[model samples]
Target: MFTLPHHIEFLSDRWVEEGRKFLVGEAPKIRERPAPAERLRGRPLSVSGRFTQAPPHMNLPRDVGCFSVHFDGEAFAVTTSFDPAADLVIEGDYQAALTGAQMVGIAAPGAFRTLRREIDHLYGPEALKVRGAIADPMALEVLSGLFDHLGRKTVENPDLAHRAARQGLSGKIREMEAQGYTIVENAITPEFADEARETILRTLSMHGHQTMNWMLYHGRALERLALNPSLMTLIDASLGRGAVIASLSCIRRGAGPGFIPIHTDYSHVPEPYPAFAMTGVGVWAFEDWTEASGPTVLVPGSHRARRHPRSSDDPGAGVPIVMPKGSVVFFTEGVWHWQGDRTEAGERVTLHSHFNRGILRSLEARRIDEQMIYRNPPRLGEMLGEDDWFEKTTAAGRDYMRFNYMRQLLAFNEAGKQAILAEPQAAAPTKSARRAVPA
Candidate 1:
């Protein structure tokens, strides 16, 4: 298990000195514009960069030194500071800045791998680059934290875990409607949970390493678990009769002090928290969610806020949703949540399934086909995204791609008049706006 504090100490005592010897000389040159000026001419786009020196002619407070690249309706303006706040901000290591600036709106043809290798060579010997160790859990945790700090804040939703105790699996759907989320205890049988756990472990062992696509390839238990009658019923009630599966993945947390930043799952879904459902997430806990084990922490009643909350807004607002092994937790994509600190020994795993109304596309659209469809039970056709509803586009030509789901699609298109109103227009930028640089 990797702990952030210990990793920070390690960096201070070891990595930093080694990095200084090479990184200082190898870092990319900070000029007025690293790329050509023509690339930004007349393009309606903007992005920001962080942790480096500010560009010339751009004024910012001494403390906040981020820079921006803007394309005002006509000309491109690259400067430091947010005069007209950028549409996106690129943050992370030097490579992120180079890649982001190079490919602003259009794709650029170049060998990104070669570029990275050349830069790493300048940073010093290969050991100082820390590439090989990134696969280690501790190293990955440390790298995640460093990038998060260098980049924009993940979520602005306040932590409201304090009010979680008020909910005890009563008035399940009603509670979700009022508060934007709810928890259901004993949602699955102990035997089912055990089977799912074994399936998950076996799949992991077969792969020999962790990758994002495991849920799509293996884990029959997970696919069956998604079709659980009770779980589907809950989703149907909230997202209407034809809620479809957006993604089905497993979350495993080994004994460590690993922490995921607070954020919402609204990336695919359109913003301006709607009155109805767009995307919903279900987390089936396979182990007891306790303080020592570091279960998920969420803000109670935050879904109604219709906006993402910041960690700084009220950090204490969050409470951990502790439950037994057979329990499942359901929340709208808008609800703010994050992984809590795990100080205990052993590994914790949860089956994560996200559902969206039929009008939206599935996150794992390509992975699910006729062969995989035949394996699941008949009742799961709609939720597993095996029906015609997933095939046809709405009258307004909007589905998961344009709008989030049915509710947002219907709300935005009233007959022919488009009601494209931005909710809480000032509630910070979307997650994409925060980290524009793709890793």
Candidate 2:
């Protein structure tokens, strides 16, 4: 079946090798078809790509990433060097190029136009630079089709499976399904939590406010944490694919009484909420959460009630979610929850990442920041609502490119979730067993 490897780092040597394999493997079947064979007529075609500002994590050997694929009518060759005389040359920001590659397949027939529109809208026109020209117009279409097929076979979130397995998230997912909430302890390293806490406090100090929204834009730390792979997997499982960010907010609470009352997150809805969840929230704790430290309290199995908690409804004393620092608690499906009283002297800092299903409107307005999109991967754009079809309209029509792209992405995510769920649950290690392992 020539299945792809479970993981392939983008722009790595392995990625280039797999790309060559895909092209070489698919070319024969493509040539067997009469239309492409007649159009090619044993003539040669080539494509050269140059990507700049490669993210440091890629650790690319070259300052500027370059690759060329040459088809000598009957066979294909892939190389790390560029070909100036190639029929087409694609040069752009590496991240934008990745976003294009992930989406090209869904924008077929108008792939070129769609790609240009998306790049212009998200990364500015200069983000993607095209050069050279195809002698035969049909050759351009053929090349587009070939790239589309190649893209579908490549360009995916490589960390989902590894992160899920490493974190033992299947058990957490099962717990969430039954209890309407689950906590991932030590999800982020204590070092990261300390850094994030400092950033939030500094931001709060500068702004002279106790709370803030759009925290993702304030610093690199918040931005990175918002797209945390394990947290994102939980969000996808609870809210389905194509979930957009409703808000990323921060709060610093001092010793005081709990101000927020018990309620469900479902904002304007009739009685008996839908079986599916429309929104979800992941709250990150920068410090150890204890009963006296004022952690969130959740009514176990209250989501099954499928309605808002009435004032007269005594849900009894709820369970306080107590976990160590660098942990996050995610609750969805209209879970009834509220803040706990803070009796301790120190302040508690938290960041809340709230997301809504793709079909629903977000609480925060969509803000497309090119620098933000360029700095991160496509995952950032997806959360910012850049990859979805909603609210994208002009006199011409709705943006079907984004619409189809999201559809394809959602299907892929669902498949990934199913695979995660199907895996056997591993038993938790005892304290002594954990201590025996090297740090």
Candidate 3:
């Protein structure tokens, strides 16, 4: 049976009724620039005269939050505005800078659509000004480098593939004990990680081959998305402004190796602002994914936290996202969930490649390579734009959101994703710090 968490129940009005209806038979289109597939990535043509420029070291205005780093998008060099009251900041890495420029190139149209949609919903109006693509592309260029690292380092490493697998498992255990969940960022070196790509794919493929809905996996999709400059820039745009994870992982089957309970990432992390400004998980695989194989089924907006704990009620207390190989699952992790898609056939296996801001603690047991992020498909250029919207993607700032969420949640490993999901929030402050909880 399918169940949904409450936080984003409002979306039911659209996501379930309209959105699901749209996706039931027809899948989202794959185009150079297709509209949102209830998500991001890709565009068609560049807008004319939309790109703009800004002086070095200057901030545009708070109203232009839509433009990520366009603090000063210029021709010679793009500038990233860190502080709302400051000028744009300058950086180097032209090859990568070109990538950011590419993102800016698309921002005029890309950001417009995204902001329009977002504003329409939350803001209840188009408060975001859809300005032409101005603002230097430099800042975002540097930002796009995040995905670049993911591709380069992992793919380049000779021993990385195998190591990542074994290490991932090991790291998961370690992080679970220390932090309740591990939040790994760059647990492995770039060159070293490259070797693990194939092995990772093999694991998912072998385990997924027996399933349904997700039998189509190629293993190279996420690698491409990692490299796409526009996409990378969008991911990077959040580098300084907000939280960006180079890599992320969460562990369950915790509390001595049973099943995980139901829960959400955002709920454990929650919203309202960054006590740990959690983020969505963008997973990539070395292969294709299918529903039968083991895709993570998400109860969208569970990040809003309306689901009650069902661990006391059922082992599969919540829904397990059925993520297709190479597909990214962007949802608040602190919500409700329990692993599903248990086909009684093979051992469950998967790898998580994620990103997050630096300040908060993560559930990953290992680090992620950012260099490789740009090399793979799901090209980066189409992922992020360069104009004011592009400028807005430059994320940079300290974030503590989602810190120790995994660690704390996993403490109840004996429970399940649902059991953990059902656990009440700490109405009263705990006596020990999260780190003190001891796995």
Candidate 4:
């Protein structure tokens, strides 16, 4: 018992007809490659729902109708409706339906610029098929091939392997290389961990919410905790010669559906699933990570798995990262992981620092003003990205800065830096030069 606005159905008919022509190979090919409007030349769409549009941040509509149809590329007639008999049932805000409709090529362009920016981050080369499938039904086999090409699953990219091998790895580093992660027990002094724990708890009371970018707010103590020398060495070992901090935040586990779901932190970057660690995470435990306390879980050796875990897969295959307070866990970005469900009554807290290979973008926004940079120690300022602007602008400039910083940080000896600098550009394995390790 639902119907659409009269105008929406008429407009939908035009788009749907266009979609059908593209799918049937009847539409003429233009100079543009993979154009969505061109492909959906004659597809008919039918949806049933009544939705209200908000100025921004829309919600899902109730009841389904033709006007409620969203854009989806898998089929030529991409549609959505909650009319019980509709193809898809959206349960949230009507604005979400509008957004999805626009995303798949439905709806008008009222606020699509902001939505497109988010879409770019969500849909990369691997998932670009929605556009392709909508554009060319004949591209099914080609799309399959594209997905295969994107997954370069192997132990490690040899160039990064060579670089890591050259670091004169300690036993811990070697273990990390073999297992994809390593837990450094008692890496931090008890007194230091206690102080950091106190700081986090005090800050948590003021913030009320669980996780936050607590580093800047707490001042020098939190900064010192994040820049612990031993932890940085381990991080740099895997992140190659010039890794820098991308974000510094805290995650406090709470009792709910779980604070964070099981997932990899690797989707932020574009890629052909690099065989090395492009991003690394360092978690300094402020309290014990016990089974009851809902510790973080990691799938052993999954860092090399170029694909993400599907819903049907077994989550129990992962092992919890259990360690004492004051210990630290370091892991490569690609590893499939999620925070464990907290069955206990209280909460557990951990300070996390995400480090990225200098070439990648930072996870959080940062400003490198002179006053702020000069206030911190030179080494700390470097991690805070004081010199990042020069590295981000041009290719040659980035290389020059990377080499210089690596030399200063002692990421490599003088001879090692010289050897790396002399190599042909193609000889470097993946663009990300660090290897994967476990936590």
TM-score of each: 0.49, 0.64, 0.31, 0.52
Best by lDDT: 2
| Model 1 Cα lDDT, one tens digit per residue, 1-439 | 1111111111122223322222122213212323222333344555454533222112334323444445453444445454334454444333223222221111123323433432333222231121111233332232233232222111100111111111112245445655566666665657668878888877777767542443755755565567554465456546654567778777667877656788887774455678767788888888877777887777767777667676467747776777778777788848888888888889897778788876677777545556455443333454555433345476876344323333442332231111111111323433432221111
| Overall local distance difference test of candidate 4 | 0.51
Candidate of highest TM-score: 2
- What's the lDDT for all of these models? 0.49, 0.73, 0.29, 0.51
RMSD of 4: 24.4
For residues 176-224, write the lDDT of model 2, one tens digit per residue: 7767887777777776789899999999999999999988888877876
Q: TM-score of predicted model 2? A: 0.64
Pick the winner on lDDT between candidates 1 and 3.
Answer: 1
Off by over 4 Å in 2: 1-163, 419-439
lDDT of 1 at 39: 33
**Under the 3 Å rule for N, CA and C atoms, how many clashes does model 1 have?**
13
lDDT of 3 by residue, 257-327 (tens): 22544555443542443423244444332223343444454443333343444445443323333332333
**Model 3, clash count?**
164
- Kindly give the stretch of ten consecutive residues in candidate 3 with the minimal lDDT sum: 1-10
Q: Residue 66 CA error for candidate 1 (Å)?
A: 71
